[model samples]
Structures are given as structure tokens and as C-alpha cells.
Target: MKEEKMRFPLSPKANPQAVITGEHYRFTVLTPKLIRLEYAENGMFEDRATQTVLNRAFPVPAFRKLENDVSLEIITEAFHLHYLKKGPFSPNALFIEVKSNFTNYKNRGRRLADLANEF
Candidate 1:
């Protein structure tokens, strides 16, 4: 049998603020932090020093700065993306899940407890 890997649709419009929605929440190999937070006096997208923060914070974001002079352009603000490889898993089965609250990830322990014996 031939092997085929699946790809998920990662859109920049989905979460303009990088809110970590739907598919992005299950990001094992990929997650979102903040790339460029600071702004210039005229509200221009300047100084990409966030790379340093990203190094320390693990996964950070990249912004789509306007294609004009930062001083003149208002830079309405947006986001960018880059493929990240986190870990190595066996290419045997393909399983994908959609979630909202990323904070509840830790409680995945009692998934199959079967506490009460229904005799």
C-alpha cells in the first residue's frame, strides 16, 4: 500500500489576531505566540525584535506588515505563518481532532476510566 500524509488548512483570515482557533489549538508541532507586539510612534510595524522573545517562548508569530512606508502607512495589523516540526510520531494511523478550549488539554487522563460498573 502507498503512504499518504494529510494536510490541514491553515488560513491567515481564520484568526486575524492569532487567537489560536479551531485547528490551531491542537498544535503539537505548531503553536502561536507573539512575534511583533511593539509599534512605532506613528503606529507603524517596526523593529522585529520579537524574534528574541519567540526564541524564549518556543513558538511565536510572524506579521504581514503593510507593503508601504511604516511612517506613512497605518499598518492595519495582521498575522503570518510558518511550518514548524515538533516531534516524530509513527506514520501508522492518522487521527485529527477539533477543539476550542486549549486549557482543558491536561484532563485527557480520565478519558476511559469506566468508573461505575454497569452490571
Candidate 2:
């Protein structure tokens, strides 16, 4: 009896205050209306916690990251994100505004890079 080869377990862990990266995009808030968008062209990003995400110790909601030098805004507690730190993901770069029923919801615009699998 000698035949063993089984190794498949990964939990990279990503909660650096609810992650938010760039250079290909990678955002993860996981709460306050859930948020987790990732697009890696070659930046390599996969913080595990898949398989329907059993748990990730969330509870760091209360965001606000307004950057300069192009654009990059993120005000959570129910979304208001806009990015374009260098451009590539079009629809005017990006958008996500949904701060709890805006008088009949009408700010729709979220094309999160899937333009026929953008090259």
C-alpha cells in the first residue's frame, strides 16, 4: 500500500482593513451591501475564502478613500465607488453609486470590465 498524493487547501487570507488595490483592480469589502470585484490581467490576486466563502471575519466597514492623480473614490456604508487610476476598464472608467434608494434608483452604471472579456 503505497500511493498518496492529495494536497488541495488554500486560504490566503485577505482583510487588510477590507482590501482595495489597483494595477489591474482588486476590491473586497465583503459587507455593508457586499462588495468584491477583481480583475487581474497579470497582477496575481486571489485571497482564497472561496467555495461560497464560509467566512472571512468581516466587520471593518466604514470606508472612504478619495485619491488624486487621475481618480479613485470609494465611500462605503452602501457604495459610491468610482475608479480610473490610469484607465483601461471603460464605461468612463468605472462606476458604482447606490446609496440606499435614491428617489427611485437611477444612477445605474456598473460595467465592471466584461466587455466581451476585455483584452
Candidate 3:
């Protein structure tokens, strides 16, 4: 059987999560091992770095009326990402929810969601 080699967003060694579809943004895992990445749908970027997350919505899709962008949620130690669609109060909008680490970040007093939000 052929082993499937996954493609990292950037230099799997440096910024594996540095993927981009046009001007959209990507997330980078600062953690050591288990480094993976994913891309955020256009129009969604939540800057949770400081305090609030900013949603970048634009274009409105013209026909489908998509007025929101996607956001990248990175779960630390889980080695994965969730692609959240653009929408308000969308339970399914949660892009990616990866548990790279079987154990949550509670041990570190932080959370993977917060890390991805900052990215």
C-alpha cells in the first residue's frame, strides 16, 4: 500500500498551517510536534489575540447571498484545524475542531481554540 504524505500549508517544518486561498488567512501551530495547518474560508477572520474576534465578511456571494467569511479554529496539541463557515449563530459554522492532543490544554491553563483564535 502507498503511504499518503500530507501537504503542510507552508514548510511543514516552519509554518505548516500557512495556507492561503487568495487573500484569506491561515493559522500556524506554535507547538512543537504534531504540527499541522488549515485555511479559513474567505471573509472570516477572528482576531481573538487581544480580546475580540473580528469577522471579515464581504462580496455577499451575489447569488447565494453569502455575506460572511470563514474562520480557522486551531486546537492545540490536536494537530488539526476546523473550517468554520460564515454565519451568525451557526452551530455548524465551527470550521475545524481538531483534538491533536487527546488531552485538552487545561493542563497549560489555556485552550487550543484560544491559540487558533490568536493566529
Candidate 4:
């Protein structure tokens, strides 16, 4: 089978004042199918483990800022990503939700505990 990928390059948009201030959140829309979320301390580097978990080779998505500084959204033909900034001292304050138009009947409505119990 062939691997599917995004058709366009990723675009990143964030509040000009947003930074790694040990409380700020960074959102990068890597592709229509993938996004990278990063949090840093004291305006420094992001955690290596976090980077590892979110890293993937995919085309980037287009980004757009919301009406307010604390929120933004990214979208493609199949997926939509929304992000919200929480606070400064809370580098992990970034909240994200990804919605996809596609559906998988087999995995639908599976709870976290149910998946954990499977193993």
C-alpha cells in the first residue's frame, strides 16, 4: 500500500509576544496530518522526550491566529487543530485537540482503560 501524506508545506503562527518564558506554549503545525507542541523553561529548550514523542516526517500545515492572543487554529482538507495558551509559569499549559473527518469503525469509542486492559 502507498503511504499518504499532506500536499502542502506546514506554516507556523504564534503571538509575537509568545516565547519560551517558562510559561509560554509553542504550537507548530507540521502537516495536515501532524502537529508539534513544545513547551520550554525560562525561554530555553524544550524537553527531549516531548520532542521525541511528537516528531514525525510529514508535510506542514497552514496556520492561522485566532481573534485573541491565547488561541490559534490550523486546518487542512481532512484535519483541524486547535491550540490554547494557558499561562507563563506553566510551560505545559498548552492544550491541543485534533479533529479528523475520517472515521475508523473498528476503533471508535474505545476508552483509555479498555485499551490499557487489552495489554
Question: What's the lDDT for all of these models?
Answer: 0.25, 0.71, 0.35, 0.42
At residue 17, what lDDT does model 1 achieve?
A: 45
Candidate 3 lDDT over 1-119, as tens digits, reads: 99999843321222223223224444434442332233345546533322221222211111111122444444444433444433332334333344443664432334534633543
Better of 3 and 4 by lDDT: 4
User: Mind giving the per-residue lDDT tens digits that candidate 1 earns over 10-92?
Assistant: 33322244322121122211233223222123323322223333222223344232222111111112322221112111111
Ordered by lDDT, highest first, the candidates read: 2, 4, 3, 1
All candidates' TM-scores?
A: 0.17, 0.29, 0.24, 0.40
lDDT for model 1 comes to 0.25
Clashing pairs in 2: none
Q: Model 2, which residues run further than 4 Å from truth?
A: 1-15, 26-59, 62-77, 80-87, 109-119
lDDT string, candidate 4, 20-102, tens digits? 22244555555555555555555454433342443333343444445345544555554544444444422232323345434
Best by TM-score: 4
The number of the candidate with the highest lDDT is: 2
Backbone clash count, each prediction separately: 0, 0, 15, 6
Which residue pairs in candidate 4 collide? 10-60, 10-61, 20-43, 23-88, 30-60, 31-59
Order the candidate numbers by TM-score, best to worst: 4, 2, 3, 1
Cα-lDDT of candidate 2? 0.71
Angstrom error of the Cα, residue 108, model 1: value is: 43
Comparing 2 with 3 on TM-score, the higher-scoring candidate is: 2
